[model samples]
Target: MSTAGPDCPQKWCTGGACDGARLDSLLTEEARWLWEQLAARADRSGEPSMTGGTAVITAPAASTQRAAVLGLLGSRPLAPGERRRIRLEELTLRLRQHGERLTPGAVAAHAAGRALGSTAAERARQIARTTGLRKLRARLAGALPKNARLRPSEEAWQELHRTGRVARVLQHPQPEQLLKTAAEVLRLLPPQGRVDRRLLAFKAAGDPHGLDAGTDLAGLVLAEAAAAGLTTSGMPPRTAWGALGVDLDRLGGGLLSLGVHPDGWLVPARFPLPLPPATLADVSWPAPPHEAPGCS
Candidate 1:
């Protein structure tokens, strides 16, 4: 038997030295294409077919139909690139159902039933590491204090630097740099009124998503606001942030009314007809028995 030369396409070369690497690559591609086609067909056939508010098939019948459909897919013709999007959608659904942290390598390994090569694995690790860093930075941002003049003690900085986890996650992390950034952000916060969350982030960190919710900097700012006597009790996340002088978003600005009391009547801002003075007599409203009564 003759070996395949460097120039040979290896399509017909089935000898022992017929370029194992090229054959493996081709096989991997073909396997991926077949998987996509099968996944797409499965997705299409798995959708519920309703007739007059009733399913066309019961659980057992659906299983039988699915088996039959799978058997028939080998003979059926597929459109070019038709399965590409369906494959991705199916993969996403599977990942969500799996309920685990998703990464490119994880997805690939899940599909292939084996670990990826060193190059692909390293790429995935890099992506995961970068994502982790971003989350850590956001957390730090949220925890920042509102007082621009307030500085972390040298001992505190030394302690932070000594932490192994912090050193691993942050690239060239420095206490002075963090403090400087926090000070800049704190200076932008108004003493009495709220500012747009995105605007504050951009002004302070040059990125709108920098001080977003769950970020360390945002948390710190909120803590400072609370210490300054801002009332944020029972408020939504956006409202709470707003009370701390940061508008989380454009919406959710006004008061949120739960509902009207069962016995209460709506009062018109402008009355069409004048009412008698007796109608406006001061009547004490009954308080709930669970708690002490207090004036608003």
Candidate 2:
């Protein structure tokens, strides 16, 4: 019954030392596949697999800074640490996808409100003094889609979870509320057309802190315009949708169900609605005739 020789140590092979060379040759196809999966995961996460342990991807300072800056503006008093952690990763994914790299850190002294190194203090003031949302919006500009459109929040959120194991349903807009939001978009259209879509969206969404570009409301506002067939050239549909306020990956399917095109415009459907210039009599037609008293 003894068949071992060159590869076998003495009479019997022990542990992995003797069979190491033949291990690959001995593996079943399924085992190889499982190993491949584990290897791929390790490659992606920059960490190797362990016996029963799990990997935890720490949030980079850039994402953490972004979260704190935004939270300072207005998040649930203080979001749960776990929630913030998830958001950090989400922000990292979003930024990376857009062809930008952000290393985290706020000016140490500025974070503490003091002066330090010749330029460090100034740099801190520049980056950390977020009196407005301008900087954040600029960062997300490149990551936006070239041709975006809006759909119902429900439709978008459902599409967002179609495949992912870790699914999220962000900013679910109400039917009635969004219908009115659509009306608001229409109401704000200038005679010449082409409003600063993002700015208008931020104002309407009431996020004075800033329109986190990837967020739902930001995309929804622009999507509403696309749905109205008022979207002009320039800007991706997906980007517009995200800015308008939703980021549904498959909004087209939902549009089809509603007899609307993926872009939100109806196909072979209703005669175009009249979009006459607003008259003075329609006071409510233009919500807030002027900006708040001293907005200038």
Candidate 3:
């Protein structure tokens, strides 16, 4: 007779688990395909970053999305010694909200699988061993020297977990601003459009690696450069930031960008050009007619 739903217990559930899961799935697929395309090009040149190195990582799509969220919640370049501060800020904000279910460890594990790969995993364990929850609690204990009777809050545990979450999030596409800027670049370049690669040097906060599709962008750019006969052998590595939120105080922003090349000792004969945006490939599913076997 009675037909009522049980209370969620969460404060608000607007686009909560289902929405988050959908978005995460979409982003993970997008990120992976982009990385693959870049890897394909890099393989041709024999200098592939993600494929060759032991540190290179290839995580499941779900894992990648988690990492992105982690990066947003973790350490920022702007706040030098404010790791705890940022963690407190974000975790407190999330916990203060009712019914929130996301945790820092979940975020960290996902990101660790996606962004850092093997190298990052080691770093994460080190952080735990040296400066993780126990360390933070100890630090808190020391900081309250005069209190003589201070106990860590539940909020503190939340903050501690948030660090890994932020770190993971930062490894993804960065903030929406960078995406907007990228859209502008697409508009400016169009198909077969050539521009000074230097123009975009500072357009992104850091290197393409920090960007959501850093590997893809880097691969495409390098491929384009090689196609134009440009030499990327002597270029210096550059880094940039995503500047995620409107306020821009926290470091929920980390994106990377760089030019790719087919091989070393190559020279350029023409100005740099952007790969056609229409050529953007989706790797979520199997190859369609164009890329399928025996299809022209």
Candidate 4:
């Protein structure tokens, strides 16, 4: 009997053609919806026009003054019947004060820069709103278990649900998943003690790299740890790790300066005798540890 493999299925042999077509269709639908929404919100007040009205210059007729007036006139298109009476000398003087040249190119560039800045500000606002909402949901969910008696009002719950529905349309993950992961991570820590960072990562996330430096999970863990007073800013990295029972190798400790000056000077400054109490306070004399001078 001839031993030969059966012919490959046509669907498998197509090599992602079907998947690509489906993805393209989805993207086109999303783009159509976005365009429709934008169009519905677009301003349709007036038709755009170049030089809506005539420019009357009131300054002394000079070559530079005429150039400045023409530059300003043609920098942007004027609206319908929008006549501008400009004193070319005053305009040029103000431009100089602002370190900008009184030229058409400079005016156009400034306008373009302002437009880009406005777009960037809008995008930043959108991102801030999304991030704030996500954090708010996470915080509320985290507190719900501890404050079982404290429940959200019906109106507030409905509003949150409506907002979450909109967020779902934007393809963001549900807040429940974030709360679940955070709860699991928090459970790894003892009520009155600390646990090894790496061990906790392995147990909670099943990945040694879950809490690695620069990771979002690491930032979240560290922030929660600090909030709970499990870690302190004064602790060096090694001490911080050791406090959590995490063993890190090839990690350097904080540096100390001893008997050395960057300017190569080692002489002690001589002060006049019989210093006043204010001067003593300035030098922090006899202050208790962790307490500032001039405080009881």
Candidate with top TM-score is: 4
- What local lDDT does model 4 show for residue 280? 31
Instruction: Please give the CA lDDT of all the candidate structures.
Output: 0.42, 0.33, 0.32, 0.39
Best prediction by lDDT: 1
Model 3 score (lDDT): 0.32
Q: Tens digit of lDDT per residue, candidate 3, span 196-243?
A: 333443354344232233344433333222223332423332211111
lDDT of 1 at 20: 23
Arranged by TM-score with the best first, the candidates are 4, 1, 2, 3
lDDT of 2 by residue, 1-296 (tens): 11223334442222222222323221333223223333333344433212223323222234433343342223533232323322334433332322223101111111222222334444445435332222322333323333333222333323323422102112243433433443344344343434444555555655432234455444444443443444532577655533444333331222112222223334465533332222211323224557997798
Which portions of model 1 show Cα errors greater than 4 Å? 1-172, 227-236, 251-296
- Candidate 1: tens digits of C-alpha lDDT, residues 34-120: 333332332333321100121121112233333332321333434333331223333333333333222222323333443334344
Alpha-carbon TM-score of each model against the true structure: 0.27, 0.20, 0.16, 0.33
lDDT preference between candidates 3 and 4, better one: 4
Higher-ranked by lDDT: 1 or 4: 1
Screening candidate 4 with a backbone cut-off below 3 angstroms (N, C-alpha, C), the clashing residue pairs are: 51-78
Global lDDT for candidate 4?
0.39
Off by more than 4 A, model 3: 1-170, 190-193, 203-296
User: What is the Cα-based lDDT of residue 253 in candidate 4?
Assistant: 28
How big is the RMSD of model 4? 21.5
Clash statistics: count for each candidate: 18, 30, 41, 1
